[model samples]
Target: MSLHEDAVLVLKAYEGRDEQQRALREVYLEHLAEHPDAMYKPCGAGHVTGSALVIDPEGGRVLLTLHKKLGLWLQMGGHCEPGDATLAGAAMREAVEESGIASGLTLLEGGPVRLDRHPIPAPCNWHLDVQYAALAPAGAVAEISEESLDLRWFAYEEVAAVADTSVVELLEATRARLGA
Candidate 1:
């Protein structure tokens, strides 16, 4: 199936209450089972595209986007697109597009260094997120878009204190995975 088709399926999966969504997810999982490499190994409800934890090098801060749809601060990411051959590459592209950072950004080798699975709330199934680490200099300026109401950098500790529990957990996991 085309990437857009896959995205549609995913969107449908996420649009329902938690229990209802789980049923829809089983259908997607059955589809994914046919194409193992195009998705990920151990493919199931949790297997989806990856996300990135972007860090500003100078101030030791992290970049976060206020997701328009979810109204929550989240890492820049989504399902992989057709142009992307790997989950990591799709994550890098999403980061650049969502953050509007023009400067060259590089992924930390051996990252997104963490992987985990979480439910997408009700009406939508679940996404198995593969998380990576990306580092950029502190001087980088972000250009916001409709996808986010705002984008900013926060000190790691400060971010942990303020961000939602799930985000905080991801941040902590990224730090531990990257030893940063």
Candidate 2:
């Protein structure tokens, strides 16, 4: 199936933990239904983006990239590519690409951990972000990518201070999934 189809199925099957998330899931499903090109970056109406939070459970820390364009310390994720077969694969790919921890990084088994929709610059009004959590292998080291201004590992409690609410929320949901 196409990535668009995969996104539809993923969103349709997603059971949001809160009213806001549930509402966003419906919005995403509708967007995909209306726009066949919703999986790519050129969609003028905005598109579905995939992202994963790289976490090291044993170390009690998460890897965050300082986004070059936004200058915010955020999770490893970006626009979905044409080659992607599933939303979750796109997220995992971005996590590996951005975090530079390519080997042994695995996504949490329960599918996406959260969904975030936010406005972007002109020509693209919104980013419907499907977020997942990627667990880093113990002793994994990260290299800096051109897309980021910096890369750092932040402890569980330090996330709130360095990152925004969205990142904090993703981390919380990730930890909850890990039963931390």
The candidate that wins on TM-score is 2
Question: Which one wins on lDDT?
Answer: 2
**Candidate 2 lDDT by residue in tens digits, 17-92:** 8999999999999999999999999998989999999999999999999999999999999999888989999999
Residue-by-residue lDDT tens digits, candidate 1, 57-172: 55768899988878788777777655875556777888888888867778877534544456765444467565666777558888897789888888888886657765776677
lDDT of 1 at 12: 46
What lDDT would each prediction earn against the true structure?
0.66, 0.94
Residue pair clashes in candidate 2: none
The estimated TM-scores of all candidates read 0.70, 0.98
RMSD of each: 8.5, 0.6
